[model samples]
Target chain A: MSITPFNIPIVPKLKKETIYSLARKGSRIDKRKLDQFREIKITLGAAGKAHGSALVELGHTKVLAGVKIEPGRPFSDMPDQGVLNVSAEFLPIASSEFEPGPPDENAIEVARVVDRALRESQAIDLGKLAIIPGEKVWVVWVDINVLDHDGNLFDASMLAAMAALLDAKIPQHEILEDGSVRIIGPPIEPLPVKKRVVSVTIGALGNVFLVDPSLEEEAVLDTRIMFSFDEEGNLVGMQKTGAGWLDWDKVAIAFNIARNKYTVPLRALQGAFKS
Target chain B: MSGKKPPFPLLKDGKRHDGRGPMDLRPIQMKVGILHNADGSAWVKMGRTEVIAAAYGPREPPMKAMILPDRAVIRFRYHMAPFSTDERKSPAPSRREIELSKVIREALEATILTHLFPRTVIDVFAEVIQADGGTRTAAITAASLALADAGIPMKGLIAGVAVGKVEGQLVLDIDQVEDEYGEADMPVAAIVGLRKIVLLQLNGVLKPDEFLKALSMAWEGLKRIYELERSVLGSKYKGV
Candidate 1:
């Protein structure tokens, strides 16, 4: 499909060679530790119209997430639970290669990965969102828009979505005598969130595994593996992407590095709420 | 789909719901060059799940803009027939299908020597005729065989499987029942010859140690599938 990424050229040979050579030397182009991540900063309430919103910047990459909660029909299978819809748009404005249109595989991948993290962790207690059992429940929508493309959009978008979900408030509503809901002006109750989760992406180049790659570093990456963890250190989700392969041992190493460094983003999420 | 768990335990004594042990895999069957007019094709059946994969091209790309200077572009799509499931699924591609297509492509790309055929497109389409569970893994196994049948140069073959937790037990080659009721499911694909994992995804909750156990089990499962794939290819070549 045109929505999928195709025909994209690999990074320039010279740059790829330089990165590979540096990796062979156990050094990086940006001089950060192999396991180090770029600086991360998150801003909550970036969108006023949204029930919850966050803007996240990781190095030069920027992502905005907004949450809108509305009373609506629930899925047939999950009649008592709320519906969580996470979508992402990779606007052309973010990068020259990112065309404006429907969401592509990359965007879908991001949204699905983010969605899995939240759902698996039981971050939101969906059963609590029921307005009328099996008929009506709250629908929580998370729309993530990429403003700039640098690298590690996965981590940035998840961070933004989590922060937004945490900051979200549900509108007041009540059931009438006939099970119809009465309208309410503004939201007051916090979403029934029970856990905090963040994902870590580790990009590999031969023997060297780099955490939270930059745009330049990402172009030459052989493969990348990501893991999501809850605040209590429970492993929630895992995904491996890119064209390269990794041995099982290397995956273990990546997992350990992720387990240790995940606190970086979790702390950033907590710090956002404190201030 | 009903989220209600079946009243019976998924596993009793040492037998799973299907009468297999926890480590037992559903029976597998495969055939190569099954479809006409395709450069290469394969049909694979694992348990009740059935999938067919076809590979075409390494020829000129349909769009001039799609030609790359370095390596051939690989386009992949994983689809399920409307009647593949108990319920009639929409023919339109869902987000899950889209994601699976991308992930399966990335996994197969690791084996293809794309640089050998530049400025072209290598197309692979995997269609599921039945959906039992682990269709993506079955599709990967079938696609790899189709590519091999097409005579594409490759570093190695790929085999895929999923290990999941059901009833607090770590089970190999999860089926639809286990997948639906299980607490966690992780699908994995590997280039067993290279001892490298090319594709992996985890959904549901898995502790760290459990993750390692499930991965090791998946690797073991892949090894068996790889052997089956190799023998099938060898038999096909012999018949020709």
Candidate 2:
């Protein structure tokens, strides 16, 4: 982590007001429709040194995911399972608003959301990662580096993380006679991916629902709900961010939109691994 | 130091290990204004060393104490990602990073007309995502491009390059292998138009005459890098 300065500037009130009015008319400042997402591009194995890596672009927002697997002790509560550690860095170079420092609240929130969605949904088969049950288990560390942030980093980062996991391969190892393990060869065996999880974020401004809000729209957003769904459309994880509240009807609309929008990201993720 | 020689011969048949003449630089690719949220951003790839730099603000200083009534302050940060190296580095800014940040700030501050924006701060964030060697110079070069892209007033762009001695032969653009085993390393940053050296750091040892030789070699490398910088900036605003 780098050093961060003390003061952070805020978005202008006039801009927020303009964004609010534009949303009311079913248009966005970026000219995006109410339920439209920006263009998405995914590149697999962007970080050649990492075991698995993916670079994702949601319009102007860019996120890189790198996965590193190492042998480590399993948690006491989960001896038969491997560990999945996900961390997100809101790199200072990404945006003017982001500062250089340790993971801030927003960074922590993004990491937790991505982590919960993948872990709770059982995207990776942890049992296959277990080498010695209680003693040694493979730990997968997913490091999400935000290169550029336009808006909607949550979805972009989640998509990259999931794709990186899919692209990951477990390194070949040998169980030694003394019960210790030795990494013998290059990375082999594609990670056991059980399901694909896609996270969709919906921003609310008054009575309007905006999909994939831009930075300006996010500034004026009253509330935001992130829904994480699996391929089967199961609600694996859900989190409500911001200070505003959402009634049941608005939540229902968000859910429906998330279900419908899951395919967009799913197609993008599949296309990345296909080549 | 123990009299341990380098594992491999750094020079053979008047060519360096990578099979280049004494003054040949590695391939360089640069892109400007790549980040959407940043006011100005640039990405540079010199061989395997990849760095991205972003510039924000001639805005109010973040801290009151940092405010300068006479001129704007340049807040520069140089960071290497945890996974940037062969071994994972801790995310914390080390003493080397802090010192590099100061040196990089001084290098760019020489060219920037800070007096034009008093009581303001120009933040330059440089991150080395992949490092083979000479990351400091690479970062500074990218940062200068980012500042220019940000529309910051400057006398001219600054170009950075390093000259090193390997196997008793002067070489341009030291890579990771040469950097570790080389006899001497000299990193220099200069104002491209002014021909003034703003940053100069010498490691290992060099004779006074050899120092002059290294400086000249660095100057030539700087000229090539400056051309690339100009071309990258030109491509950004072709009509203008």
**Per-prediction TM-score, please?**
0.97, 0.53
Please give the interface root mean square deviation for model 1, in Å.
Answer: 2.5
| Residue B111 of model 1, lDDT score | 87
Candidate 1 residue-wise lDDT, A56-149, digit = tens: 9999999999999988999887789999999999989999889889998899999999999998888999889998889889999999999999
lDDT of 2 by residue, B1-240 (tens): 011366788899988888878999989999998999888999999999999999998988767887776678777889999999998999987646765775677667667888899888888999999989889999989999999999998888988888888877889999888887776667777777776556655554455456557767888899999999998899889957
Off by over 4 Å in 2: A1-8, B1-240
Query: Candidate 2 chain A: worst 10 consecutive residues by lDDT?
Result: A1-10
Looking at model 2, residue A48 earns an lDDT score of 88
Q: By DockQ, who's the top model here?
A: 1
Best by TM-score: 1
Lowest summed-lDDT stretch of 10 residues in model 1 chain B?
B1-10
- Error of model 1, residue A82, in angstroms: 1.1
As a whole number from 0 to 100, the lDDT of residue B95 in candidate 1 is 96
Would you list the clashing residue pairs of candidate 1? A171-A187
